[model samples]
Target chain A: MTDITALSEEQILEKLLGGNEIVFEQVFNKYHSSMQSVAYAIAGPIIADEVVQEAWVSALKALPKFEGRSSLKSWLIRIVANEAKTRRRKENRSVSLEAIQDSWSTDPRFSENSQWKNPSSQWHGDTPEELLSAEELKNCIEKSMLKLPENQLAALRLRDSGGLSMDELCNILEVSSSNVRVLLHRARDKVLKVIDHFQITGEC
Target chain B: MLPNCKQMAELASKNLDTPLTGMAWLKRKIHMLMCKHCSRYSDQIKLSSKTVSTLDLDLPINEDVKKNVEKTYQELHCRKDVSQ
Candidate 1:
């Protein structure tokens, strides 16, 4: 029904807890895409599928303990994040999220920067060939990213890719805020050099 | 207007997802209008962010995946918590 479609997630949660599997399915359908995106964003495409699966399991198990302490979606997402971490651990990898227990703290903007450009700044390169060629460029950069030290790779991915704040990066990576920023800047510098080399020399 | 350069940059990144506001945003906009190099840096940073965020990882969820996910969800009803 349109009314049910318009129901708040809270209402859905109530139905789910009331033992309505159909209502729970609704929640699953609603979040499935977003949940997968977040997991994939953190762990790459390979494990993201498994992560979401485990998250569903975990969410179902954790539901009884949720205690209505947060938004339904938020609680479910926390489980999703945990599942992503679990997948990372199983793979012996933690590229983007270092670990949630790190003591790093930061003021978000990082060390900060000056200036800005016109809002219209776009990354488009000239020529359809150039656009088509960017796939190669991304590969070149990805290869370079693999050469980075573990911490730097994690920091860069978390900051630039995950869009995590310094505080979040610190929490995820278990590092200091200052260290996170420093790691990010250094990693970025290296990536920039690699990208430049690829563009100029066309070599990986 | 906001506070410091670092704060502005941080806010700028955050604003990438949202909106700019307050004295800091206004001041940063002013600084941007006057500075080309910083603007370029910001743009580059943003572009790089997109590149890293999106990195060769996006794939459409084909029907097989949808079926597997649904099957998994159903099987979840068969077990208790194993997340410990």
Candidate 2:
């Protein structure tokens, strides 16, 4: 079996254009999740799969004209993001940034003077790998992530998992850079809190 | 002015996406030197961010959708070949 992961971008493009089924499957498996994440972030869960399917169709149709301007993964992600946005508009579902509450102002971790009222305790696991080793903690994190506000979840998914640039994130989420930062921060903070609680108590 | 603990927490999260620089960077460093709690908080957020990035959140693609996409690809490829 050829190592598709080892192939260069140009090589992958060639294989894809040549209609290599194996390469196509490999590529699909590699990016399908990230594409779905972007789609879910924009279009919501109900139509996210539909948006990704549409994105794949569009990407395949336009594959011949791919100029290699951005990475193949990035191009595909942008396609899904656009498809999800259009679908969202059609469904009359707007992801309102204003709906996100600014919890930082009233966070319980800090004191009235902005000092640490309840500081974080030492964790048994320091690295991400170590923390994720516990299956329950992983589930807890995922659950917390799913419960985050729509825009915040979208920002985190795009920036962290999708590996999109800040500019791309702003463009996709249709928010200012500062607003993107807030969304990203809130999402990450929730994850941090989840892990912290899990570490301290060993329960979800 | 030095950023308080709340501001430091925000900076730490922002630093993960875009590195803090100039005064912000210097201030975070200075504050970390004095406040162990904020330092730990920053480190924890960084760890969580790393974990989130590494998560495999991809739900499996439906088999029917997979087949349809493959079929569409083949039809497109044939059309291109005929045109060439």
Best by lDDT: 2
Model 1 RMSD to the real structure? 9.9
DockQ of 2: 0.60
Error of 2 at B48 (Å): 1.8
Task: Put down candidate 2 lDDT per residue, A128-172, tens digits, no spaces.
Answer: 888888999998988887788878888887777767899988877
In model 1, the Cα lDDT at residue A107 comes to 29
Query: What are the chain A TM-scores of the candidates, in order?
Result: 0.52, 0.86
Please list the C-alpha lDDT of all candidates, in the order they appear. 0.57, 0.85
Clashing pairs in 1: A98-A172, A98-A173, A99-A172, A102-A174, A109-B10, A111-B6, A112-B6, A116-B39, A117-B39, B2-B24
Interface RMSD of each: 8.7, 2.2
Off by over 4 Å in 1: A2-4, A96-169, A173-204, B1-10, B14-59, B62-84
Docking class of 2: medium
